[model samples]
Target: MAVTSVIASEASLFLTPQSIIFDEKSRSQAVHVVNRGNRTGVFAIRWIDHTMTEEGRLFTWKEPDKSPWSLQPYVRYSPRRVTLRPGESQLVRIALKKPYDQVPIGEYFSHLNVVMLNKNVEESIRQQEEGSEEAEAGVFRVVARTGISIPVLWRHTRDQPAAEVEISQWNSSQQTLSLQVKRLGQVSTRGFLHVIYQQNGKEKRLLDPHPLVIYPNIDGRKVNLSLANRALAGGKLYVYYSADKEHWDKPLGFASIQL
Candidate 1:
């Protein structure tokens, strides 16, 4: 598995509105990528397709086979290469191209990947004099580059999917919780989830608000979390979800399971 390093908005830079949606009449939208680092930041922007699987994992592709959910061919964004000084921002405009009549009837998804280049290392290398001790040591200095990705989707139809969840596996010995979240209906289900634990008249809350998205290509996601407490013989976990747009943080329904 690959490890990811997350950067906060003020220190590292970020994209405003991590996700985007579109109305039927809108043709284009723009996203801003800001640089909060001390040095000039270089970014290489590109569009990629992601397919959610039945097991709830996302698979990305540069060019995928034609399907109801592919978003690569129709998406366009610029300026693909950006050079910004510290605390500067740039606009990346995304537009959808057509043969609209040929687009499939379900939701299509794509991602705008804003990848950061190792500018500090490049700067260091440029300043090095020939055959110097400092230059020889500079070759071993590792550069850790980081960036952000945003999901953009266009739904061609009006069918909104229903989402459901169940505890598929719970390992009390390991203090792990596993849930199988399923999505129904024609469109994807994007929501927020809150997890709580209860035992012996006491309650404990876990997770500091999370985003939930179940796409059309994936039927369900199997999520695993660890429970730390060991004293209770009987414990139950309660979970709730709500749609993202107008119903953010409000639970439409909740479910519980005994451990």
Candidate 2:
């Protein structure tokens, strides 16, 4: 009988300040990337543009040549590639090439992607080819190159937008809540969502700090959140959209529904 064993390897990378925002006052920004894995990590960084659907699905911008809303054209980054050892860190600096006024009065956004190279995977493959006894015993290895993308947005000085939240739909059987964040005014707004379940006299938080973004081109975004394994009978659900993840005291939008 041949015994099979599977080994999985992945890169451990951490990023600080999940999102980046640039306005007239700020000229540049920095993103910190740390390697938490024991092995050295090689990463490639670049800017990518994406469009969001009503259901909050991201797709690469199809019309790159005519994508007026893309922020890639005006933005620049440093250190396109880097090699980080364990407990090492690198800073990726971003700056705008064009003046703030030169841009149109709207929100432009793109994603900064940090992708891990498969150097470790190649090493593993080379080792397996050396013919160890464990390899003869049917040892299979699977390696993954993980990557992260963060939204980077730049808004004109005159562009200001407001957001409002509404409960679009609900499914009791599926324990799901659907919401639409409506955008009003010129620019777009990005923030986080918090869902609270109030039953009897006690309250339970169902969703804490989910990303919410409504671009300038779109009227609103549809977000569906699942509330599985949580008691929702005879309760009132409150949803709040806040400017940042740290504080919910002042919400940009608020909505509630009774079950």
Candidate 3:
């Protein structure tokens, strides 16, 4: 006889009103989790607050609970355990009650996590005795797990005018190398650009410069580095940028050239 199994559908969770805009007033919003799967699934919902501190450390907060999930805080249900039938869904109401009026202007981010308990594992555990062979099977059992990422942003009024940076041309005359950066949306007052080049399994910094404040929406500045001295004839070049010099975001641009 063929065995029947339960499978969770590919689902997603996101904020409604997409992005939140608050100017010193209380706000309320709803976060929805949709069940796109063919089978009903149970979800444990919670909120995670990731904040950047003044000392450059990251502080995390789990909503409705003082201790964080990572720290093993008491687990309480925000919407309780939710059961979604096939093609069914649920909504979680989140209110920015107090501190919304006092929050500083910037981006505040949070994500929703939907989890499915492994019924198969639970059944196997129940079938096995303390010293039975079936109990040993528990060690080899595999469980299915999936997660979705949601980003939330809260912005206040800007104190300074925006600045933009653009990279018109990035190339290595002697070797094959190119790097480019274009500011998207409103630019900040200051930023840094960095490039990392690797050749023959060795890595080296190509161009590290501190450019002046760039005006908004203007043409990008150009930086060209010739690899004649470094013998960077052909290899991989990774380029990235950031507001602070020490911390760089993932390399948005990559190029592989052969000399």
Candidate 4:
């Protein structure tokens, strides 16, 4: 075999679409994972039970959520173990096992953890490769491989409407923008965040649509965005939060920075 240095880790894994949302009537859908690096990419897939902390961080636990919409038990995905050569891709199909009519209308959620395979083995391989080079040049050192993970989410809805959102508090200092989001209702909101500035009828967008999710059962989800100093320079900065861009164009909440 040809050796071109495996190094610490390979940038071989790529995930498309980023997230998944399944309606009550929908049965199954697919996600694509591609390998873009020179070496082979191996991965393992499993569902994790997690909840959003009051601080807006993810806390994963072995005990699943008791809600009817829990994605861990109902949604089944295939090809849990994936191995792909360079430039190759695989399809991971997901389907719901429970009957939609029987379940209550609410948002149940879980995460699909796509983890890179074999951390210890990869370290051994990298160490051996490094040692071989050191033997030729008479120098020795140890380097290890790094793991990569992509977060996938699944949601189920039953005639439940979209939730309302508001920015109860927002302020910026130096380069940091902080927000306290108030999410109303049992349904969670998943979408991208947009930061725009307008002055003299001209608009400047500091940040485009970036994925964000604020779950339920808390005072609210707190979040912060780091911006360049020029993002809010001499302009009216507007923070717009919205989902369903493909279906709706209006923002769910609008806020401006003061003090």
Which candidate number maximizes TM-score? Answer: 2
Clashes of 3: 3
- Comparing candidate 2 with candidate 4, which one achieves the higher lDDT? 2
lDDT string, candidate 2, 116-232, tens digits: 875354455667788666667888667576798888888865656567899989888888988888987767777799898888889777876898888766789988899887756
Cα lDDT of candidate 3 equals: 0.46
lDDT against true structure, model 1: 0.71
Q: Give residue 208's lDDT in candidate 2 (0 to 100).
A: 64
All candidates: TM-score: 0.71, 0.74, 0.44, 0.67
How high is the CA lDDT of each candidate model?
0.71, 0.80, 0.46, 0.64
Q: Residue-wise lDDT of candidate 4 within 96-116, one digit each (tens)?
A: 786766765566676676776
In model 4, the Cα lDDT at residue 130 comes to: 73
lDDT tens per residue, model 3, 1-259: 9999965443333234433332334355556666666555566765565543322244556452442212112112258457666566777755554534454444333444556643233333445644556446666546676545444333334433232333344455555343444434432223565666777898777766443222232323344445456655567665555555765553323243343
Candidate 1: minimum summed lDDT over ten consecutive residues — where? 244-253
Query: Any residue pairs clashing in model 2, and if so which?
Result: none
Flag regions of model 3 displaced more than 4 Å: 1-26, 49-77, 118-140, 158-163, 172-259
**Runs of candidate 1 exceeding 4 Å displacement:** 1-13, 53-56, 65-68, 99-101, 118-145, 169-177, 197-211, 230-237, 244-253, 257-259
- Residue 23: error of model 3 in Å? 5.9
Model 4 spans with C-alpha error above 4 angstroms: 1-11, 65-69, 119-155, 158-178, 195-211, 217-219, 224-237, 244-249, 256-259
Error of 2 at 160 (Å): 4.2
Q: What is the C-alpha RMSD of each candidate to the true structure, in Å?
A: 6.4, 5.7, 12.1, 6.6
